[model samples]
Target: DAAHTAMWERLDLDIEAHDALLAVLGKFYGDIYLAQEGRLKGAEYLDFVLSEVHGLRIKELQDAKAAGKKIVGTFCVFVPEELTLAAGAVQVGLCAGAKAGTELAETLVPRNTCDLIKSFIGFKLARICPYTESCDLIVGETTCDGKKKAYEAFGEHVPMHVMEVPQCKAPCDRTLFRAELVRYKEALEQLTGQTITAEALAEATKVVNAKRRALQRLAALRAAEPAPISGRDALLVNQISFYDDPVRFTAKINELCDEIEARITKGQGVAPAKTPRLLLAGCPMAVPNWKLPYLIESSGAVIVGEESCIGARNTRDCTDETPGNLDAMLDALCDRYMKIDCACFTPNTERLDNIAAMARDLKADGVIHYGLLFCQPYAHEAMKVGKAMDAAGIPYLSIETDYGMEDAGQLKTRVEAFVETL
Candidate 1:
C-alpha cells in the first residue's frame, strides 16, 4: 500500500483524485501513465492494463518507429509479448484501440449484433481506431465464430494473419488453446525472433491481473450508496484501470472506495433520475463504441441495473489466485468474464422473468429493451419481454440499433418521447 501511495503522490492524486485525474487524462490518450504505474509495482501491473491500453499507446511507439524508431509491432493477443519485445517491436494488442473503444458505435451492423461487434464494426467503418492504420500487422484466432467472422472481414484491409483454433469447447480445446498460445508464441519467433521465456510470461501475468484486481474493485464500489461514482465517473475509473499502472489503480481504488463509502454514508450516490428509473437488460454494448451508460446517465436515466455479462458478473467475481502470471491469470479472468455470457441466444422467459424480478428489486421504474437490429434471439425475446412488462404494468420501451442507421434526430425524438411517457 505504501508503494502504491507513493506513486499516487507523484501523480498528485488522493483516492477521490480519480475525478480530478480523469478530468486531466481524458484530454490526452495513450498508455504512458499505465506503463509508468506498472513500474511502480512490477510487470504484473503493467501486463494487466496491456489487455486494453497497448493499442492506444502503440500510436506513440509506432509513430516513433515509423520515423526511424526501432519499434517492432507484435500482434497483441496472438503474438507472444516476449517475442514482440525481442523483435524490437511493441507488443500491440489487436483489439487495443478497438477495445478501450474509439467512437460512438450507434450504427453499421444493425444494433442487434451484440455490443462488442458494434464497437469494432463502428470503429472500422468510422475509421477511428489508429490500430486500423498504426498496426503494421494483425493476427486472428478462430475462437468464437462471431469474433472470427468480424476479424476475418475486417482483416482483409490490414496485414492480417490467421491462426486456426483447433477447437472451441473446453478440456480437449483448452490444451489445444494453450498449445495454440505456444504456437502463437513460435509464430512470433519466426516472424520476429523474440524469445518468450517462461519468466516473461510469468511477468506478464502479474502485471495484467493487477489491472484486473483494480477493475474489479472499481466495480465493487458501485455497490455503494449514492453510488461512489457516476456513469461518467465509472468510465474514468475504467480508463485508469486499462491505461494506468494496475498497482496504482488498486491503490486509487482503495482510496476511491473510502471516498465512495463516505459519500454513501452521507447519502450521496449517482444523482436521482428525474425520469422513471429503468433497468436495462440484454446485450447493451451498442458495440463497445457507444458509451451507453454515459449516454443513459446523461439522458437523466440511471442504469441502476443490468444483465450484461461484463457489467455485474465480470466486475463482481474478480478474485484471481494467480496474482502475477499474465497468461494463467488472463485465462482465468477471461473464463470468469465469459461465464455469465448472456444467453440472449434466445431469451428464456425464465431468465426474462428473473430480470424483471431484478428490476423490481432495484426499484426500477421501467425496463428498456435495447436489443440490436437482427439480434434474432434478443429481438424475439424482447418482444416477449415488452409484452410481459406491459402485463406486469412495468412501463417499457424497446429500441432497435444498427451501425449507420437512419436519422438521429428521429431517434432522439423517440427517446425524448419515451422519457415523457414514463
Candidate 2:
C-alpha cells in the first residue's frame, strides 16, 4: 500500500481525493459484490483483479513504460486493441464511471453533458484515475456530438487523438473507417516508434479474438436455467476485460467458464431455478457504475444478459483474422467494427433486432432499458426499443439516471414493481 501511495504521488495524483475515492469504491464493492451468496469459486479471480485495478495494474503499466512500451488509453470500442498491440503499446480503458469532479468538469463542458463525458473530465481534473495518468496517449472518438465537442476540452488536458466513427453502415463508410484505421495505425506508430508489421498484426488479432471467444463462452453459459453465475459477477468480468492483460484475462475467463459449466451441470446457481430472468439493454455501464444491476438483482430478478457496448455489443463480433496482409487486415478490422449496433449510428435497427434476439436466446422474462441521464443517443433509442419489445410481447421498463445515489431508492421501487409483473 505504501508503494502504491508513493507511485500515485509520483504520478501527481491528488492524494487525499484519490484516497477518499478508493474508500468509497471499496465500501460500495463490499455492499454490492462481496455480500452476494453462492458466488462461483472462479469469482475470486474477479475480486483479485478489481482489488488491484488501480494498484497492480497501474504498476504493471508503469513497469511496461519503464521497459519502453507506450500505453494507449481509449474510451470507445471503436479503437482497435489489435493495432495498439501490434504497435508495441499497452491498451487500457480510461476511467469514466463515477462523479468525482463534476464542478470542475462543468466548468469545461456543459452542465447538461452526459454523466459519462462529465465523469471522464472529472476523473482527470480530480487527478483520481491512475489509468488516465498512466496513458501516453488517450484516444477519443466522434460517436456523438457531446463527446466530439468535449474532446476539444479533453485534448487540452491530455495528449488526445480523435477518430471519426461513421454514423451509417455503407460502402463509402467502410472506406472511411478503413482510412481512419490507417490514421490510427500511423498515430500508434508515431507514439511507439514501432512499425506495425503484418506478422505482428496477425498475431495481435489472434490474441484479441481469443479473448472474445472466452467471453462468448461465458455468455453462452448464462443461458442455463438458473444462471450458473450472477450478472454482477459477469459484468465485472466484462469490465475487467478492458483493463487486464489480454492473454491472462482470456485464460482466467475461460477457467471461470469451465467452473460455470460444472456448476450448471450440478444445478447450482446464484438464484433459484424459477427466479424471474431479465435482460439489461441500453447504455454502457462502466466500472463502478453498478447501481442499476444491483437494483435489478436485489428486486427479486436475475439478469441473464447485457445488450450494451460494455457487454454483448463488445464481444459479439471478433476481428476477422483471415486477412494476411496489413491492408486486408485493416479492412477486416473496419468490417468487424462496423457491425457494432451502437445507438450513435443512424437507422440502428440492428440494435433493436439484437436486443430481441438476445432476450429470446437467454430466455429472459423481461427487458429493462437503461439510459444515463443526458445521454441523447440511448435515450432516443429507449422509446424505439420499448415499442419493439411491446410488439414482440416482452415485458419492458425504461430507466434514466446518473451516477449519484440520490435516486437509488426510487429506482429500486420501480424495478421491484416491474419484476413483480413477470
Candidate No. with top TM-score: 2
lDDT of 2 by residue, 1-422 (tens): 89999999999999999999999999999999999999988889989988998899999999999999999999899999999999989999877888889999999999999999999999999899999999999999999888999999999999999999999999998889889999999999999999999999999999999999999999989999988888999999989989999999999999999998888888898999999999999988889889999999999999999998789999999999897798899889988999999999998998999999999999999999999999999999999999999999999999999999999999999999999889
Q: Write the per-residue lDDT of candidate 1 for residues 3-70, one digit (tens) a residue.
A: 43343344333334333333333432232223221021233333344433423354455455556433
Model 2 CA deviation exceeding 4 Å by range:
none
lDDT for model 1, please.
0.49
lDDT of 1 at 88: 43
Q: For candidate 2, list the clashing residue pairs, or say none.
A: none
State the displacement of the C-alpha of residue 323, model 2, in Å, after optimal TM-score superposition: 1.5
lDDT of each candidate versus the true structure? 0.49, 0.93
Q: How well does candidate 1 match the true structure, expressed as C-alpha RMSD?
A: 10.8
